[model samples]
Target: MQGSLSEDRRAQGEASAGLIRGELEKVREEGGSGAYGVFGEQRIAAALKRLGCGKEHGVYIGNGFYSVHTGVVCVSGYVTKDELTSEVHGAYAEPQPGTGPCVENRGGH
Candidate 1:
């Protein structure tokens, strides 16, 4: 077993961010639709649900995933997926537009 999981809210957000980053990275490397495809709320939502974060975070997937429980955002940023590198960063409390340069409002309730 992996010792113990972090109960820290920030750490949990990072975990979710990491998953998204990984996906963006793959698409970036492949040089495909990741710029837009990764932004799809449905896909990201499914992935988040599989990660079992929804319950603990009071999560609902729309753009990325935000914590209704803590009022903390777990995912944010955009994916360039072009010749440029994709961007992924920490969550912001004030809801952001998922369609633009942000990721659940992103999925916020």
Candidate 2:
């Protein structure tokens, strides 16, 4: 039962990652115009890498937000779609407290 649950979560995370990747590609192809344009694809890519969701890593999306979690850090944010432009907007990274290295090491001997 536990194994199945973990598998299910992994599958769900993969699906969400695919969706986020597709959206990101669309924004990049469109020259990063709109809300997504502000941060630009490169910046997003860097954040994703830091969060362990770069091209070589996996992403996790939950409740309409995309996130990447490394052992020492996590970054989560939303990718709003622009109805008019059919592009992604408002893509921002929200730092997860207590997940970063500093937080994890706090008060540790």
lDDT of 1 by residue, 1-109 (tens): 0112245756765655676566545544654344344444445444446555454554434433333232343354444433323222333445345322233343536
lDDT assessment of candidate 2: 0.40
lDDT of 2 by residue, 1-109 (tens): 0112255555554555555466554544565445543434454565455434653333443323445543223334554344211111212233233332111222323
> Cα lDDT for residue 105, model 1?
45
- The global Cα lDDT (0 to 1) of model 1 is 0.43
Give each model a TM-score: 0.38, 0.32
Sequence-dependent TM-score of model 2: 0.32
Question: Highest lDDT, which number?
Answer: 1
